[model samples]
Target chain A: MCIEHKKEDIMKLVPLGDRVVIKQLVAEETTKSGIVLPGQAKEKPQQAEVIAVGPGGVIDGKEVTMQVKPGDKIIYSKYAGTEVKLEDEEYIIVKQGDILAVIE
Target chain B: MCIEHKKEDIMKLVPLGDRVVIKQLVAEETTKSGIVLPGQAKEKPQQAEVIAVGPGGVIDGKEVTMQVKPGDKIIYSKYAGTEVKLEDEEYIIVKQGDILAVIE
Candidate 1:
């Protein structure tokens, strides 16, 4: 666990159309082969769990709305999202289309 | 190296408008601490060397062409690009807008 305390109780969880807010899950220490990844070599997974989902992305130059909601586990591209740190909590803002698949 | 024989022949190296071709660099075996990342947890960086660049993305629905051309090093979103395996070589095709920055 991080030295910083984990804070819960999110109220204002509204995402813009087609935009989604995700809280990254802490990656496991051991790999599938039971080997540990070094700090420098550890690549952050592109996948994240959806904390808040926005409406669908803009359509025809106008916001069309969204499909997924909050609490959805999604797999996104490794290169997607703009990093954001809110009160020591790291979050990512990404467009809906950027998400590739939803993990069931 | 992949088991397949490496083929090197240049006839057509064209990327569609706003699109670029890139050859992915192999991730190093060791980390900064000289530790290796497990294969299952290896996260590919969202960066690639521009092989062929298309014209700028379609402007107002028409192809606007591109700013960068072949042989440019670019950093893109990890989630970007549709992967393609061509003759034993993996290549990614992505729009110019998806590129984050050009590596100097």
Candidate 2:
């Protein structure tokens, strides 16, 4: 639970082999009906900002090509990806296939 | 379920790219503790005999080379693959990656 790490530490993370590191966007504070949800009541957003994309290469005997890039806004599959915490921030690392679509 | 389908009908199954058709081995009737397991009490075994292997090629933008061949005994991941029943027989269709190991 250390919040004292430098931002440089977070930037040092490099995902390998078609895995992309992403930062989940904060959940909407108000519902469509304008009801403000409590902190724990909010659903985890499936939308994320791509932070890093792995290099395209062969993995598990299958050739993979990374299709997304850093700074892209994407929607990912629910319940997919592993969560990683760094420098007081959290990120989800997932494969390119986990990203369902990119938002305009 | 019809029990009159010819064996040729089952042999005619051709697995598509990276998929394999396998027949599950019957669960052991007796445990090492010398207790007989009722039909409903037996656990589904993970081992299966491969009936067909997919032709390896580019699939989903990845190059794949199949490793297992027909008649090979293999262990597959639990909860993986789809079950198909025909003529009083059951088979599982799974990706080659789901086959964890081949028994010599």
Candidate 3:
């Protein structure tokens, strides 16, 4: 038998322009340099797990699809993304290009 | 006689696509519901003083100018903007449309 699912069970669908939705990696996990960051550190790096991506960037009035996909672990610039709170859970949505590099 | 100015004094010109640069108001100020947010508040409302604005939004392939300008104190969606640290000072850059409403 197949089970039915609610919309909440699926990631809410949001169409973005050359953008993607990222489920932010918990701030406490990732480390930088040779030392681990304490909880109270003022400048914690923002890392995220990709959830959804837009079709592609619009270049010269043409729509392009993205090279990245969901489930990629990415290292975005600290200054990237707009912080959003969805039902008390924080998420960030940003352009695909804003992602500096992928964590291998 | 007049004195010439440097680029630093000119707000580092950045031409954005319907975006704007905002000098975030010192988080220490601004109150909500008769209560002021303390420095330690986990969730501080991000209010900003507009320093620069883009020409306007791009609808289709046409460019449009912004309705607002520099020095406008506005309230933006908390989730809006990409943060940039310039000379150790934090500023947020976002599309003019991200500004939800102007504060009275």
- Scanning candidate 2 chain A in windows of ten residues, the lowest lDDT window is A7-16
Query: Which stretches of model 1 miss by more than 4 angstroms?
Result: A1-104, B8-13, B31-41, B57-65
Runs in model 2 with CA error above 4 Å? Answer: A1-104, B1-11, B30-40
The residue-by-residue lDDT of candidate 1 on B1-104, one tens digit each, is 66876557734457766677887655456767989864335656554678877765555565443555678765565677887777776789887656644444
Per-residue accuracy of model 3 over B1-104 as CA lDDT, tens digit each: 23444445533524344667787776664566666655535565677888766545453356567876788989888888777543344567776768887886
Candidate 2 clash pair list = none
Best candidate, DockQ-wise? Answer: 2
- Superposition error at B13 for model 3 (Å): 4.5
- For all the predictions, what are the DockQ values? 0.02, 0.04, 0.03
Q: What is the lDDT of candidate 2?
A: 0.75
Rank ordering of all candidates by TM-score, starting from the highest = 2, 1, 3
Is 2 or 3 the stronger prediction by TM-score?
2
Ten contiguous residues minimizing lDDT sum, candidate 3 chain B: B7-16
Question: Lowest summed lDDT over 10 consecutive residues: which window, candidate 2 chain B?
Answer: B38-47
- RMSD (Å) per prediction: 12.3, 12.9, 13.4
* Tens-digit lDDT track of model 2 for B1-104: 45565675354568999899999876546767998774435555566889999997887777777777899876666678999976666789999766655544
Ranked by DockQ from best down, the candidates are: 2, 3, 1
